[model samples]
Target: MCFRKKLWSIVLSAALVLGTAIMPANMIFAASDNESQLQAMAVKSGTLQYGDSFKWTLDSKGTLKITGKGFLYLSLDDLGDIKNDIKKVVIGSGAKEIHFSFWSFSGDASLPKLAEISIPLTTKVLSGSLRECENLSVVTGGKNVEDIQGRVFEGTKWCQSTEHVVLGKTYIAYNGTGKNVVVPEGTVAVSEAAFQSNKTIEAVTLPVSVKKIGSYAFKDCSSLKKIHGGSSVTLIDYDAFLRTPWLDSLNETTMLGKVLMKYKATAKDYTVSEKVTQIYEGAFSKCDNLESVTIKGKITEIPRRAFENCTSLKKITMPNTVTNIAYGAFDHCSALAKISLPSRLKKIETGAFIFCRSLQNVQVNGGKTNTKLQSIEDAAFAGCNNLKTLTIPWGVTTIGDYAYGYTDGGGDENSERDMVQKMMWGDEESVPKLNAANIIGISQSLGHYYAKENGIKFTATKKGSALKKPTVMINNSGELSISKVVGATGYEVYDKSPYDKHWCKAGTVKAPVRKYMTYELKGYKYKVRAYRETSTGGYQYSAFSKIKTTK
Candidate 1:
């Protein structure tokens, strides 16, 4: 299915190029009356390339024609030489995004001769692609564009003449002088910095169709006191309402629709409401007074810098619904001591828990077969000097560089000197060694590979080895009997009632005693596993036996 989509995209691009090439020569020349002057200049007509995917053509008539199937990459250097001669830009179909490089010098227009542009319906995002085109006046097409990022039409003649510049379903740039504004219906997005630095605007009302509010959308709107109709919004980018009176007026915990946007309360402990389905980046950042946080909602990911710099934070509890912990989610959380990862978590991004000086115990719940964790990215647990041991899950495949047991050497002079030398001369031995003394995981797993590669001692647990699954039976006296396999020092019994969410530890029996008293309640299930004492005094357990229900 994926291959077919790629083939279709390639075929469509070729057709777009062919369509543009077949335009009659007379039609191209008929647009200008000074044909003799155009011919005398000997303007070069060839392909201009940006990146690997985009290619454009400039004709002798000063017409720039853009043809592509994907993103549009524009740079000052790419068009700086011929920018003065290009008067018109015609974007052909199949271009999905447009990005323009910032001006070479502040307040200087790059394309002085550019007067008109035509965007295709395939373009969805226009990220300041035409900004600083001082002479640009006419804009055609782009009736389907969804996002207009960062003052896209700023300083253009077209934007200066229009009060509320909107392209398709996105509210682009706003130039209105009114103190209050109401976005029209059917608009789905308010682009980045759409109303940036507008001091007079005291209130703004959005239609229900708007789903995304871009970064710095209302930044520095000092007089803005109310933002109505945010119940349908699902995504709010970083600092969308920063430095605004509306944001200052909000309560400690600000919820825009289902997303938790900010947490400003000074309380020592806080629990997120269960209704929150998502958390914005830096939602609770720099909260030095916060000691503990409990997330009990349907959020699927912890965004970047969600709780960064919360030095007093010692503990955090998250529900199992979370899958990904983004980069720097818990960075510099010095007081964090322990955390229990969700069973369904898939990836821990780079620097997810970096500089967590007090972090010690990281518990990965669920059995080997149930946990879905896959990768531990670079610096995930770096600077955690107190962490002594970690048990990587069996499902994890990759352990990134410095994912665990790396310190930044804050107070120690020798370690700081070593760090500086390592950076200057690339001295490998000058770098501090892994802080974790012991690492445990299944044999031959990535955990074992990391330990071997780092010269750390590893304790590997062989699956179904001497500590095989114990034989569990219910005797006539209502007691559970377990027949253990060879080389077992003890047996651990677990049971779960029908209403329980997870199995609970029943009891532990030594090698000679294989029987355990059964629970009095009916409809309870039991399972037993054999464990052997390791050389380091840690217990290695075999897989649980087949479950047996009590009558």
Candidate 2:
């Protein structure tokens, strides 16, 4: 927000000081060597009027200064086939960037000859109009303008200070090099690839009116430090600020919520807006310094690998409106201390929480239905060396491969296994509801798990086993022998679940379970089946195991 004050002030002053260059009186319109004549630019109301008195020939290339009050319209169709002519056009004060709006009279008349144009800020307009001006340098704003189109100012010098550009609108895209830019109210979008490869960017702000940011819009800016997208911006490009080193020191807060999209190093501390509704892939993929996040309302989906490598995230708060989480959502967050899932989440994708080595606790709420809460994706919690406990919400349908991860092993085959399963119960009533947060929960439980595939730890009520003892269990298999079907490379077991069972090797692989009739210390069950790989690739599966588990 600091950038707005400075940029708008400059825009106001720009209106008053429109000219330092005036037509030199005696100059006349002259023809060029290539049969083109130079004419004066038409300056309009609130815009400085100059070169109007006479025309000047551009036989040589250089910087041209357009001194005007409000706007300047130029026709360059007669510019002919010359590759380039005008090198740069610098506009001076009391002049708003919108006053220089012009249409290309010639086809394909891109950049400098009509190319490198610079429009300094002066007055307040509804939106900054610099569409298709690829060669434009700097575009600042007034307190009034609303949104700007994509790539309006690029390849120009003014946008070089990414930290200072001030903007106030939506649908705008810019180069990374501009000064601090701010998105004001009533704005709607920040298009993709808007600001790519900027070197001098300092900061950017998104007001509540913003909805989305196109991909890579702010990648590679070396100086960008702050991005204020609190409760305003929604969609952020996955790789928007890919390699910016300064993002590490930024102050990210609740504004980032579900709108956050991060990559590599720029993901630190960025917050999502409280009102955000969705989170996509690679959002906050690898930020090491992120500390906390609060999910406020109606977050419907969390895409694959959403929080893949946020090593420094200590805590996360989620509201009750969430329903699904895709694969690898929290994959390598070794430093994450706690996480709480909404009561009604139905699906958790593969590898959703793999490799969270330091997780201490997990809290799950109710709202689970028998069929709806049945499936847990593959590798959901793989490699969690220190996880201690987790509250398994009711109605769980599927617990896939590697549900519980392994430990470092200490290189001993008989090393003492982790005791994480001992603490996985009872978090239903402890998690209190958050205020104005659409059922967000602040306090959380902690748990740690080993890094291997021992599966989740839980005790089943005694039904009747030949022998009684403390036991943890999984599939209840039966002796089965099978052979590959002629045209089939792999096969599947159908317990009537909606998902297609995975193909297994021709030899054998455990059958994926969808229903749990019983649990723990039941006798071992094994079967042999034939299979082949499918076009989707992997071995086929066999029929479901006929045996059941009873404790």
Candidate 3:
């Protein structure tokens, strides 16, 4: 049978190239007494049909051959109980189109015995078809099948063989138990479960034409060590390499495709390659030690939850190529003290940078009045307790619910303004210093309008003139004291200690008093600094004071 199939294949190829009218494959059903005789001698025979659209004849040899001309839809359930007994299938060459369904060739235990199937050259196997066929093997024909779905041969012997499985032009599966495997070039996709549950394969190199990797494509390849090439892959389904050993050590991050789906790297300062165009959902979540990220890619949109809960990410460099920041992209990045937004950033989605408690400053290009920034989603900057300076671009139009100016709970309970008021004056009773205020932006448009509507203080620049630096000392009464700078109207004290972390504004002092202003202290090794606040609101400070332990 193999020799005959090969010989016929060569003849068909030769005939096509030479433009000769060759007869179709061996069997051609005809109306005759001989056909009636064969039917009588058959073990089982019947014509299955879906109205007038499709029809097939099931013969004794377990071959469900297409009898209808042009096109036919082969749905497994439509074929009677004999469907389970179909060991081999021969789709007629005359059939131009064949549509398969999820229930077409699935879930029947007897499917394991289906030894071979011959699909027409023009068939289109849709997604979620013929999945989990544990033992059926030897799929032939379909030289022109264009849209073969992932998992079409999953759990089947054809997918588990020690050979690369090529269906039409797509290299869908590789069950080779070698230490190294090289995917054939020109293959467009790597289908789902293509190498699933395998234990021997150590490395696989995908070709560049491969644009998509289906879900769980390499789900449990326990020994998969390296994946090389695949520079052109645009979409990688999450968990494509789940439970694989090579995920965490993927040093060449760009090979994971343009869209980073799951990142388990432990690097402290990760830099995304320029080839990466998008960062997919949960790409870098829960990286506790990640201190900084330099995204130099042309990523237009940061997908949902891309970097959520990365508690140690201190800083991020956004490239101008970023247009839209998606929902929860950088949520809960607790250590991110400051971030610089790109000039072209258009939208900030819901909770994009929410709960970043240590976020103190956000700088965007204030000169870019023609910026694409349109909206700031709900809670986009909420829960940012230490946010001291925010430079809203002039193009920002809409601010969603609790966009900024508020914290975790709504309705003034955790408002950032209240928190700063408490931190600066200890209570609202004491006079407030200028540096305690949040510098709104360099030049504002709608942000100023909204701030006015919401009674939020916003200004294009700091309010006061710059003042001279103040001196820090411990006063005789056992309190931390800040000596007033000569010509300054007031002084702002800050506790800078990595032991407690973050530069927190401690207290404020009015100038012109003879004695140094002081405060009763909570003992901690602190590197304190005093910046003099001008009568107009700008601040100027000397170098940081020496580290001192509170007595």
lDDT of each: 0.78, 0.47, 0.64
Candidate 2: regions farther than 4 A off: 1-187, 200-208, 226-231, 235-237, 251-317, 326-340, 356-371, 385-408, 411-551
lDDT at 226, model 1:
84
Better of 1 and 2 by TM-score: 1
| Model 3: per-residue Cα lDDT over 1-551, one tens digit each | 69999998998687668654564544334457557657645765455464234556666666766655555556655664765767777877666655543243335654545677787766644344555345567888877654455566665777666588888756677756688888788777777767778888899898878877777788898999888988888877656777887875554443466777556666899888887766766778787878888888887777777788898898888888888888888887888888877777889998898778788877665444345676787668867767755666545545665577665333243454564444333242331222333536433244654565445678765323333344556755746556555555454455544354334555555555423333445464434333443333323344445655556
Clashing pairs in 1: 383-406
Please report the candidate that would top TM-score against the real structure.
1
Candidate 3 segments whose C-alpha is farther than 4 A from its true place: 1-54, 59-61, 66-74, 92-113, 124-126, 131-135, 145-148, 251-277, 286-304, 310-551
RMSD of each: 20.0, 22.0, 23.5
TM-score of each: 0.59, 0.36, 0.45
Judged by whole-model lDDT over C-alpha atoms, candidate 3 comes out at 0.64
Give the TM-score (vs. native) of candidate 2: 0.36
Model 3: worst 10 consecutive residues (lDDT sum): 426-435
In candidate 1, stretches whose alpha carbon ends up further than 4 angstroms from where it belongs are 1-57, 68-82, 101-109, 149-151, 154-161, 263-275, 285-300, 308-328, 331-336, 340-351, 354-358, 363-383, 390-551
The superposed Cα distance between candidate 2 and the true structure at residue 200, in angstroms, equals 4.8
Q: For candidate 1, give the lDDT of residue 387.
A: 79
Task: Please write out the lDDT profile of model 1 over residues 1-551, one tens digit for every residue.
Answer: 69999987776577568863644465344446556656755645445466437667787767888776887877777787788888898989988988877375767778888898898989888884566788999888998888777777877898777789888889877888899899989898998888999988988999988888988889899899988886778778777888887776666788777788789988999998898878988888899999999998888899889999999999899999999999999988989998889888989998898778788888777434336787888768867778788778756745776677556666354664555445345344545765546777776455765777667778766642345668889866669988857878888788889886446677889888888998757888998877765553334456678898888
